[model samples]
Target: MRTRHVHPRPADPTSTSRRTMFVVLLLCVALGSVLAPGLEPANAIGRTSPAATLPSQDDGSSITWSVRPSPTDADPERPNFGYDIAPGVTVTDSIRVRNYSEETLRLDLYASDAITTSTGALDLLPAGEEPTGVGAWISLDSSELAIAPLEFVDVDFTLTVPADAEPGDHTGGIVTSHRTPGVDDGGDTVILDRRLGNRVHVRVDGPLRPALQISDAEVSYTGSFNPVGTGSMHVTYTVTNTGNVRLGAEQTVTTNGRLFFPGRTVTPEPMGELLPGNSLTFDVDVGEVWPIGRTTATIELTPIPTRDGDVFDADTPVESASVTAPTMPWTLLASLAVLVGVAVLWRRHRRRRERREAALVDAAVREALADTPNASDGSDGSDGSEQDGSEHDEPQHENGDRDRAPDGTGAGVGGAHRSGERRGPPAPRGNEQ
Candidate 1:
């Protein structure tokens, strides 16, 4: 058997850049929910479901055909076609298309350029779109095939590199597809095209530059209500492969609060591979970050060489980007303020209560004195007896005076002197001059 190679599409840089921007926007909107308490990273927003599988029949039957890279002598189990050719050189490859249905099938074979989807997965351009890169370089031996049931056909193709082809990676795919008549939900007739393919990676030998860049970095914090509690620091950024060589990377997110107090350091799983000129958006949440007024987050991407399509050397310097945002502990401050207010209110209440109690005690004492008749009269028991004796003595004197004659020193004068003696010298007058 002759050696055969199957090619897969490579990443399209322009499309990848656009998709990266879109991903950044999406991540920004979903960031709050991602950092919400008690949520898992897997449940983060912006995640998309898997692409729907193309139907193989009008009646919604299972796929009855398949296409993939075929085995070859150079590398029998090679997954896809990979090549390192110099300028003005040509290569050969093959793809196997199998028909597993009960009847024979007709298929159309073609090549298309590769592009990165918005979800960061690889996909091919739609049919009828002209490819300008590896897809245009590849030419298949036959464009149509008729295979019997349970049989497969090996289609050959030629990949010719132009004499002036740029010395880097070029990617495309070898695919087989079929068209079927279908009706849309709007009762309109449509053509349903389903395709399957293998990828091709071609590299022209030349000087390789492997570089990575970090862009649009953003940092935000979500704090807890507890004064001493820890919060989450979210870091988001876009990573772009700006060099000509395919590579991988080691991603790390480091955070620091005021005075360089380390919050959290996150070293996520390393990136396995990244196509040249492609971009990827990353979202990382570092937990247990204490809000210390402000926090700075740094995203560092270290290039890692990939050995899938061609020999790679990622000796470039590490790329880093940073962002800063205020992380004030508002909830904690509010709690402290409430406590202070409560203390002040309690102090005022206590002082008012003490003053009220003092006034009440003073009034009670006044009431007790009023209830006693001699409390402020300044007279004792001896004074009351003296007054009673004086009244009796006065009556006796009057009787004696009446019995005495009307002489110059009669009884009346004697009675007046006796009464004056009993009264104790007329009791010094209160108004005496």
Candidate 2:
């Protein structure tokens, strides 16, 4: 009875075809899994990676630093970075920095633009070495300080409260770096950067400090390392007093050393105790500004009836600069030439001395060779003497590093002595009559 139904089941070719198709599809998926990583992402299949999308930290740029204060004035101990300063005042702030890189880097500190170009010292600092801790620069100081790798240091900056400094927040930043710094990304060019800036809110009460005025403060030749009569900048301060008491105050100013101005000490004068409504205006010279791009100082002020150091506090910063004064090629070349000359001269001198010593040994060795082969008495004394001579062999000189012979003559020893000694015993000296 079951035989009739069994004979009806024919070969299902459609089912076999479907099974084969599924197996082929599975193989393709498995192959893709192995090769997918080598293939580009959907969006990047035909294009190159965008530079913006890539990291460009220390690829080739130098490392720079922009130390910022705690954003506020709960503590005004930072150099030139303080709180509300009166129109007639100055303040000082300090910053700490380090080169968190493998190679050595230099750190330079500077201030930048204020309300007006003339408002703060905008001296240009020359490329110099990095610093470790608190350091100062001025228009008159050498631009050759340096900061070693993996080392940190402090830098002091001053904030100037112009006798007529504008009332309200004046903002700027301190920039530090090397002419050739190693970027954070371990690049070839200078790229390391640290920036710390704050907002300066100056309030000037017409009576305490007034005049919405401006004054020119000049810091002159500060140190012994200037080009005689060079390196000086004219700074203008904005004065504003929006307080109740006739305000007497202190302020700190900062600038770029070497290129801007440095040696930042500030001086503030009283606009007199206003009857809480009257205002005063004037200008006081801070100190010498280094030839940096930024310069600043701190000065203390006492209103008609004020106390010492308890004066108002704030900072006057000259924020930024246009790419106007690029360092001259000749200047850079000159510096390079000097460095090369020093290095070359030192090397040449060393080579010259080495040659002279080598020649003396060559001559001595030749003589020893001839004597050793024939002499029958190869005694211990002779051997000891030769050893002593070898130990003492050096470029002989008479009191100085200049190459010389046993005699005081400044000459190389490879050739025969000019005295016609014929490379033999420094001619036996004859007792003169």
lDDT of 2 at 352: 100
- For residues 274-358, what per-residue lDDT tens digits would candidate 1 score against the true structure? 6677888888999988788988888888887766444444456899888998888888899989999999999999999999999
Candidate 2 off by > 4 Å: 1-66, 70-80, 114-145, 177-433
Taking all chains together, each candidate's TM-score versus the true structure is 0.66, 0.24
Error of 2 at 361 (Å): 99
Task: List the global CA lDDT of all models.
Answer: 0.67, 0.37
The C-alpha local distance difference test score for the whole of candidate 2 amounts to 0.37
Error of 1 at 198 (Å): 0.9
Candidate 1 residue pairs that clash: 5-94, 7-199, 7-200, 8-172, 8-199, 8-200, 9-172, 10-171
Off by over 4 Å in 1: 1-63, 184-190, 257-262, 308-314, 347-433
User: Residues 177-253, candidate 2, lDDT per residue (tens digit)?
Assistant: 33212322222233222222222223342333221222334333233233332243333444444444324334434
Lowest lDDT sum, 10 consecutive residues, model 1, at: 42-51
